[model samples]
Target: MKRISLFLLVIASLFSTKTVFSQLILGPDTLCIGNELQLSTTVTNASTYYWGFCSAYLKNLPAGSSIAAGTGLAGPSSIAMAKDGNHYFVYVVNATAPRNVIRYEFGTSLSNVPLATDLGNFAGSIPVNPKGFELVNTGGNWYGFLTGGATSITSDIIRFDFGNSLSNTPTIVDLGGLVLNPQDLYVFKEANNWYALTNNGFSGNLIRLEFGNSLTNTTPNVVDLGNPGSLSDPSGMWPVFDGTDWHLFLVNRGTDRLTRLDFGTSLLNPAVDNDLGNPSGLLNQPRDISVIRDCGSYYGYITNENSNTMTLLTFNGAVTALPIASDLGNFAGFNGPRYLTRFLRDKDNVFAYTTNNADNSISRLEYNTCSNAAPPISTLQTPPPVTYATPGLYNVYFASDEGLPTMQVDCKLIRVLPHPIIEVNNDTLICQGDTILLVANGPGLFSNLWDPVYNTIAPYDTTSIFIYPKEDYRYNVHLEFTQGGGCAYDTSVFVRVSRITADAGEDRL
Candidate 1:
C-alpha cells in the first residue's frame, strides 16, 4: 500500500513541474505562398535549429501541422524577404565572433544535405553586438542599414551596398552617431527622398536621418523627436500615411507604453496624437510594432519582450484620434517575442508572424475579430448577401488576454455614386415685367449648380433664384448634383411678357 501511494506522489510532482515550465511564446515567420503555410524559426540555444512550415491558415494554426525548414542555423536575428517572393535572406547571429546571413530558396531548407551557394558572414566587417537592420531598394539599387557596435558606443549605423544581386559582399559605409545608441532601424519614403528612422535607447529620443541617391558620402539630416516622459526608451517606430498626413506610432520600453506622433508639414515638429501616460497595461518591455490595414480598419500588433506576449489594437482612420489596443490572448508557445510583421495577403483576413527570442521560435496568428465578427447592432435590414444595411458608421470591440481593457474599432461606409432625384416647381407661367421666386429641391444631394446666372446667394448653393425678363422667353435652369455623382439634370419654365395699356378717354381714340 505504501509503495502505491509513493508512485502516485511522484506522478503528481512531475505534472506540476510541467505546468510551471510551460509558457506562451510567439515568433515571426517568413512568407511562403501556395495553399500551405511555411515558417522558419531561429532557436538560439541549439546550434541546429528547425525551420517549420504550417499546413493550414493562421486561424487554423492551433490544429495545423508544421515541418522543419532545415537544420544548422546559428540563431538568426532577422529575415528580409526578396522582392521576387521566391527567396529569403536571413541574418544569423550566434555567440560566435561575426554575425552571419544565409540565403534560402523558397521551399528549401538551410541544411539541405548538399547546400547550394552559402551566402556567408552577414556581419562582414561590421563590429559585434548586432541590434536590428532593414533592407530597402531604391532606383534599382539595394541598400541595407545594420545597427550594431560595442555596448557603450553602439550608435553606429552601417550602410551596405548590395549592388543589383544583393550579394553578400557589400560595400560598407559606416554612418556613426546617427542616433545615440540605436536599437532598431526602419526605412520609409517621403516625397522624392528616402529617410531612415531609429530609436535611441540610451538617450530616450526618436531620431531620423534622410539620404538621397546614396547613403555614402552624403550628409543626412538628423532630427530629434524629444521624448515626452522621463524614461521613454523608445524601441520601435512604425508610420502610416492617412491621405493628408503621416501618423507615426512608437513603442517606448522604458516607459512601458505606446505613444503616437503626428507630422503635419514637416517631420521636425511633431505633435503628440495620443499619450496613454506611463505604466500602460501589459506593455512591459514593448519592442516592435507593425500595422495591417484591412477592410477600412488598421490593426496594430505589438510585441512585448518582458511579458512574452503580443497585443492587438485597432485604428480607424476617420473616427478616432488614437488606436485602442486589445489583448488578443497570448501565443501558446512563445517566449520573449521580439518582432511582429504581417504575412502574405489572405483576402480580408489578417495573418501575422512574430519572432520569439526566449525560445527562438516563430508563431503565426490569425485575427478575425474585425473581419469575422457580426456587424454591430443595427436597426436597418441588410439586403441579400449583405451583412449590414446602414451606410453610416459602426463600432467593434476587441478583448485582449492581458490586463488591457477591451478596445474599439470604428468602421464607415461611403457609397461611390448615389442616384439623386431632383424636384422643382413644375412649369410655372409668370409675367416678365415682375420678378418671381423659384426654388429647386433635391433630397440626398450634396451641392447644386444652376445655369443662367440670376440673383443668387452662392454659385454652388441650393437653387433658389429670382429673375425678370422683358420679352416672352423660356427660363432654363440646369441642375447639378452633389457628391461628385454622375451627369447633371435640367428643367425649364416659360414666362410671357404682356404690354399693359391704359385707356384715358375714348372720345379722341
Candidate 2:
C-alpha cells in the first residue's frame, strides 16, 4: 500500500509540471490609446466575454495591478482595437452559424457599457474551428484572415474585406488546402511585398505565405518552415523586425518551451534557437504569447494554461537571441488563461489581458504603480508653478507633497527662455572723494542691486547706488530682480575715476 501511494504521487507531479501561456493577437493598425490601458479578453465555451480598463499610471507595480472596472460580453474569441480610438471590433464564433463580427464603442470612462453592434459573418459561411486571426491592410483597403477548422472542408483560412464598417458581409477567399490545418495567422509587410504566416498544429510547421500585389489573391506562394528547434505542438507565433531581419518566436505546448526562428532578409531560409528551455519547471504548457517594444527593449508576455499564471520575458533588442523569463505566479480568479493582448504604444503604463477557458472569465493584468493605484489628489495645489529661476538646459519634475502616485508628476525637459533683456548705463567719470550714482534699465524689472557692496538706503529695491572712492578706482554695479527667484540679472556697469591735480608750490601761495 505504501509503494502504491508513492507511485501515485510521482505521476501527479509529472502531469502538473507543464503550464499554459497566451498569445495576444491584435488587429492591424491598432494603437495604444491615451493615458489609459484597455484590455478585452474572450472566454471560450462560455456565454459571456469580458473587458477591463486600468490607468496607465500603475506601470511600476506589475503584480499589484488591479482592474478599475470590467464588463462582460455575450461571447467573443478575438478582439481588435480600431484605428479610431473610440471603437473596437470582436470576432464571435458560433457553432450553429457563420461567425458574427461585432463592434463596440467606449463610453466617457472605461466602463464596460459598450454600445454593441453586429457586423454579420464571413460570407455567410461558418468555419468549424476558428482560432487565431489578425487585421491587415492591402491596396488601400482593410482585410482579415482567420485560421482554424479541419484540413480543408472546415479548416479553410478565410479572408474577409471590410468596405467601410464591419457592418457589411465580407467577401471570403479560402487559403486552407494549401497551408493545411493552420491554427493561427499573422500578416506583415516587407518593402513592397505582403506576407502571411501561420502555424499548422497537426504538422508542427510555420508556413510563410506571400501575396502577389493583392491580399485577395487566391493562391499565394507558401514556404513551409518545418518545426524549428524540433518544436512540438506550436500553439502561438509572433515575428518581429529587429531593424535588420525578421525573427520569429513561438511557444510549444507539448514541450513546455519557447523557441526562436530567424529568417534573414528573406523567409525562404531560416535558423532556429532555443530561447527558454524548461528549467525550474516554470513553463507548463504555455498556450499564447505577445511582444511589445518599450524603451528600446522588447517585452514578451505569455499565459500559462495549466498553472493559471503569466510569464514575463525581456529582450535587449527588437528581436532577441536569448531572453530572461520570470513567472508572475497566479492571480485571483484566473483559470486556464488561453489568449492575451497588450497595449503597444506606452510602455510606462503597460497593460495586457488573458482569457481563461476553465472558469469562463477574463483576467486583466497591468504593470507599474501608476496603473495599479489611483491618481492621488493632493490637498494642496501641487505642481505649484514654481519658477525655474536659474535655467540653462534642465529636466524638471513635478510631484505632490506626499510624493505618491499623482497626476501632478510630469517629468519633462524644458528650456526656460532667458530672462527679460536688461542694459546698464555706460562708463561714467567721477572725481576722487566723490560719489557717483549707478543706474540700470530692463523690461519687467521689479528691483535692482549694486554689486561690490556699497551703502544704499534700499539696496534691494533701489535702482541706483552711490559709491565714494578715496583714490582713482573703477566702480562696478549690477542690477537684480525679485522675479525669477532673484536669478534674473543685468550686466555690470563700471564707473571710471577722474584725477584732479593741485599745484601750490609753483605759485608761492
lDDT per residue as tens, model 1, 251-271: 888778877777764554555
Best by lDDT: 2
Question: In model 2, which regions exceed 4 Å deviation?
Answer: 1-59, 63-76, 90-102, 107-113, 118-124, 166-171, 266-268, 316-321, 346-349, 367-509
Poorest lDDT segment (10 consecutive residues) of candidate 2: 1-10
C-alpha RMSD of each candidate structure in angstroms: 20.7, 17.3
lDDT of 2 by residue, 97-216 (tens): 455655544332222344555556646654665566665534435566776675656567777777554444567776656667676566765566677778778777878888866667
Candidate 1 lDDT (Cα, 0 to 1): 0.47
Superposition error at 36 for model 2 (Å): 25
Which numbered prediction scores highest in TM-score against the true structure? 2
Model 2, global lDDT: 0.50
